[model samples]
Target chain A: MNPLRIAPTDETPTVNFIPDEGKFEISGNSYPENSTKFYSPVLDWLRRFCAEAKNQKITLDFNFDYFNTSSAKYILEILRILQDCQKNGNECLVRWHYLEEDTDMQEAGEDYRDSIDLNFEFVVREDTL
Target chain B: MTDKQLLYAYNGEMSNPVLNKILSTIQTKLSALGEKRNVVKNVNTILIECCQNLIYHAKDKDTLKEDFFPSVSIYKDAGGYRISTRNVVAGEDAQKLEAYLAKLNAFSPEELKNFYKERLTDGKISAKGGGGLGLLNMIRASKDGKLVYRFDPVNEQYLMFTLSFLM
Candidate 1:
């Protein structure tokens, strides 16, 4: 399958999903003007990826500086897709990265972790942006 | 300079570019002053949600009279940072917003968090692409769950809406 690579913009996040390597990462800020239009394709690609790749090891990293509420919904949807992938026998691990001093981002990670059934590793580090 | 400092202010169209510029300007100023990381993030978050709400819900500039231009500003006072927005909305929308804010103001912090997650997962996103989460997020970030807002009659069909809260 073809990889999905979307470069980050001033108002959106980077999305790099490589099926061959089983590594996906979405990092940076996400507050696009049209969140639905921006996230529709990413959700489609994820569904297709989850269906095709069975019993594989997958790693998804989410490192967000800031995301609006609309983007927050889409992020939850992304995690839900990964939850389905885990249910299909894939060993799925989500690395939730946040700035060491950003309690908002850290709490956001915890909220996403509480909703979905996945192995979530909350990693705190210095700012990388 | 006065203790009540006007850090950043915008008065005009609530376009995406303007919103980004506002956020960027505030981010730079706050970072330069070594503001607390979380406070800066919260301030930006509040600004985005507020401005986006204006972009989606406010009446078209062409339709409104000259004095009703949508505006947003960030300033610092004795209480800390404050973000405020002024916009014009239809009477019906104004009513709905008032009731919604009243309902949100009644929730405890834990209740608000639970409600936010519930809406995030299950609520329908509006035609304008909002899940009706903007005010919720603002109140979530506002100091002590206080979201001060008011509406004044602009005309027979529209109302002037003003919303502000502390960081």
Candidate 2:
């Protein structure tokens, strides 16, 4: 399958899903004009990736500076997809990165961690991204 | 009078690009004023939800009179940053929003957090795809988990809904 690469926009995040390297990274801001329109294709790509990359070690990295409520829903959706894949024997780990002083982002990471059954590692960055 | 500074204000049609410009401008302004990084992030997060809520839920701008164009303003005073928005909404929409806000305002922070997670994981996304998380997020991000709002009857068919947040 082809790698899924979406350039970051002022309203959306950078999506870099590399199957060969078993690394999936989504970073930057994500308050798209239309959350569904922006995330549907990305969700589709992830479904396909999970189906094809079974029994593999996957690392998902999420580094978001800001995301709106709508984008928050999509983030949970993305995590649910990963959780399902993990249930199917894929070794999945999530690295949630937030700015050091951003308690909201840190709590957001904690929210996702509490709601999902995946191994989560929180990393704090010293400077703004 | 308290020392109050007006940071940004907009009134008119709202689009994605317009929202981006407003957020970027406010982000820079807040940071330049010596706000901590966390404060800036929280302010921007609340502003995003507020502006997008206006953009997505307000009735079509082309159909509304100029006086009814959605408006948002950010202000800073001794307490903290404050954001307020006003937009014309259908009467039925106003009722639904009022009830939702009342329910949310009644929740403690812990209860609100649990409700947010439950809705996020289980609630169906709205046709517009936000899944009704806008007000909940605003309440969560507000300084004291409170939202002040009112719906003044614009006419029999519509209402001028106003919401304010302090962070």
Candidate 3:
């Protein structure tokens, strides 16, 4: 399958899902007017990728500066899909990035980590990006 | 008089474009204030969630009643920034929101975190795809982990809902 690359907007995130490399990254702010509409296709792509790439190792990175609650729900949905992939015998690792001083984002990462059973790493950087 | 300065306020339509404009304007204002990066980010996140609640849940969009105007205001207090939003909601929604806020306010910080995780795992997403996380996010981002709210009845069918968050 082809990689899914979406440019970032003022109210959305940049999505780069590389099937060949088995690396996926979503970064930037995400608070789309209609989050479900914006995230449906991305979720569909993940579903397809997980189904087709059996036994492949997947690394997913979520680096968000800020995202609203609706975006948070969709993000959980995406992580759950990846968790299922891991449960299906594929290797999956998730790296959640946040600013070093932004404890809210860090706590958000911890929340997701607590909710989802996967190999999750919390990466903190100084820069907001 | 209080030292709180009203940095920005908007009273008009709560459409997507208007919300975006409000967000950018507030972002610029926060940048000019020279606050810490984390402070600015927290204020921005809280402001976005507050305005979005108005956009998605405010009633009488088509009628555009004068009394039903959705409004948002940001004030810089000695402690920090205070963001507030007022919008008209259906009577039922007002009641539901009041109960939810009461329950949320009752939780301690640790309990709130635990509740947030529980909701994330079990909460049902509405038809509009809102999994009822906005209020929780606001509380989580607030300095006191509390949201000050008021509900005033406008009429039999509508109520004015006000929410304030200090960041």
Candidate 4:
């Protein structure tokens, strides 16, 4: 699988998917002008990558400040893929990193954790930028 | 300047940069008045989505020769910023929008949040259907704040819906 990385802009976030190291990350605000135009490839890559899985421990980190509805949908798709990986006997860990004071992000993370059976770790840190 | 003055100044034609400047100016002013960073950001997102909604779908049959689009207004009241839009849409669409508005009015904060999450689960990452979530986000942003709304008619064929976020 090819390394997937999309840089963040004022309207969207940065996405990094490294299959070789089994490390992935998505961070920033995601309210793109056209959400599908932005997220289709990411979903396709995830779909293809999961079909050809290795027994590596996967660590995916998410540190989004905000996201729109369309972006939110794609995020859940990514999580569902990770959940699939976990169910298939791969060690998948979701590290949901949020700002220290951003209760919304924390609550959102909790919401996802409650609905999904994926093993996730919620961590908070200062905005530190 | 007054809202009518601002609306009249458009003259049915505006350069992209000028219109963007106007939209950005209104957004900046309202965001500053909202005070909270998240609230400001929410307002910014809503206004952008709302304007895009207008640009895409605002249609009026009688005004074939006129600029049949939406009129966005940012004003003040005893409470907070009153951002509004008057877009000419189809009668059927107006009814559908009213249904959505009624649904929004009926939902509590928890209900809105739950609905957003559920839709996030069910829906694909599409732009058109994302309109519903934008409305939900506006509702979420004003959970503890204020949301005032009204509907009016400009001609016999169109309905104008005004949504206000009370700072």
Candidate 5:
């Protein structure tokens, strides 16, 4: 399947999902007015990828500076989907990145790591944009 | 400027574009306040959550009075910054929110963290993608791990819901 790329807006994040290379990423702030509408297609792509992707190893990267509560729910949903993919015998790893000084984002990643059973790595980058 | 003065306040209809404008305006004001980067970010996050809560959950817009229109404000306090929002909600929704806030206020910081984790994967996403995590996130974001709220009954059908976070 072809890759999916969504440009980020003031209230949304940029989503880059590449099924061919098994590289998926979501970055930037996400606090859309209608989060369900914004995330429906991304969730659909993940479902399709999990069902049809032939890649044996998948790495999903999440680098979010800030997201509202509704977006947080969808982020958890995406992680849950990847967890299911891992459970179905696919090698999957999630690189959760945050600014070194942003403890809130780091703790958010930790919260997801604690909730989902998957290979998760927390990467702290510099606080530069 | 007074230390505990009101920094920003808006009392009117809050749409998506208006929310964005409010956020940017507040961000600029906060920058001018010369707060630390982390402090500014924390305040910004809390403001976004509170404003979005008003935007998404506010009901009976057509019947809103001038004083009861959806509103949000930021204040500088002795401890830290406080963000507050007020909107109209149905009586049923107000009851649910009051109960939820009571439950959240009962938890310690660590317990709230656990509760947030549990609710994240509860698979009960609402049509608006709420999944019942907004209040918990607010409480966790608050410096005191507490969300202050009040419900003023307007009539048999609707009530005023006010939520505030100190961060």
Candidate 6:
């Protein structure tokens, strides 16, 4: 399958989910004018990918500098999908990279981790956003 | 002053640079007025939510090839900023909104945090729209100060929501 790559906009994150490599990353701001319109296709693609995800070691990296409530809602959707994937016998390592200075972003990552019953790691990046 | 007299109006497309500049201006002015850091962040987040609300939910119409926009206001009080938005809303929409805001107004900070976590974990609520957090953020921002809210009926197709957040 072709790699799924979405370009980031002022109000949407860049989504890079490569099934071949078992790596995923979502970064940037996501306060899209209409979040449902922005996130639906991505969610559908993710659903399609996860349905076929087999025996694969998956690593998801989330480095969201800023995401609006709607975007945050979609992130939870992604996390839920990952949780289901993990339940299906796939070893998934979820990594959330946040800017050291942004206490809000760090807290957000932790909040998501807390909600899911999965082994997720939070890493603070210095000087580079 | 009557609410109508106090409203400030801007109608046009919103650019990121313009929004950022306006937000900075609000922040700077509030800071000069002695707003604390926590207060500033809260007010800023609510303001952002309000602006996004204007951009997203406002009824759009193409008349003469221009998109009509919602009228939004930002006012300075002794304690903080207040935001009011005017738009045409259906009765059902208004009723739905009032319930959410009422629930938000009722929650304590600890409860709001728990509510946010529970909502996140459920993942079922997101389908309704992520916009629910707009009210929650307003509540979180104004934990110490009550959100003064009023919804007024206009000439049938319009409802004006005047909401305040004391930072």
Model 1 C-alpha lDDT per residue in residues B43-151, reported as the tens digit of each score: 8878889999888876765655667888898889888888889998888888888998899999999999999999988836777777678889998988879799999
Give the least accurate 10-residue stretch of model 6 chain B, judged by summed lDDT.
B60-69
What lDDT does candidate 3 reach at residue B10?
92
Any residue pairs clashing in model 3, and if so which? none
lDDT of 6 by residue, B9-115 (tens): 45555544545555677668667768665455555556677676655555545321232345556766554456665544555777887787787778777888898
Cα lDDT of model 6 by residue, A2-111, tens digit: 67899986557888999999999888767665678787887888788888888889999988755767677788888888889888888888899876666667788888
- Writing each residue's lDDT as its tens digit, candidate 3 over A31-107 gives 88688888999999999998888888999999998898888888999999999998888999999998889888998
lDDT of 2 at B4: 80
Q: Comparing chain B with the reference, what is the TM-score for each candidate?
A: 0.91, 0.93, 0.91, 0.67, 0.90, 0.69
Q: Lowest lDDT 10-mer window, candidate 3 chain B? A: B58-67
DockQ of 3: 0.65
Error of 3 at A87 (Å): 1.8
Off by over 4 Å in 5: B1-3
lDDT of 1 by residue, A3-76 (tens): 99999998899999999999999998898877989999999999999999878999999988878888898898
Model 5 chain B is weakest, by summed lDDT over 10 consecutive residues, at B123-132
What 10-residue stretch in candidate 2 chain B is worst by lDDT? B123-132
Clashes of 1: 0
Each candidate's TM vs. the true structure?
0.95, 0.96, 0.94, 0.78, 0.92, 0.77
Residue pairs whose backbone atoms clash in candidate 5: none
**Tens digit of lDDT per residue, candidate 2, span A1-129?**
999999998889999999988899999999887889989999999999888777899999999988888788889989999999999899999999988778889998999999999999999887934
Pitting candidate 2 against candidate 5, the one with the higher TM-score is: 2
Of 2 and 6, the candidate ranking higher by DockQ: 2
The full ranking of all candidates by DockQ, starting with the best, is: 2, 1, 5, 3, 4, 6
Q: In model 1, what lDDT does residue A16 have?
A: 98
Question: After best superposition, candidate 2 residue B127: deviation in angstroms?
Answer: 2.1
Q: Score the docking of each candidate (DockQ).
A: 0.70, 0.73, 0.65, 0.35, 0.66, 0.28
User: lDDT of candidate 3?
Assistant: 0.85
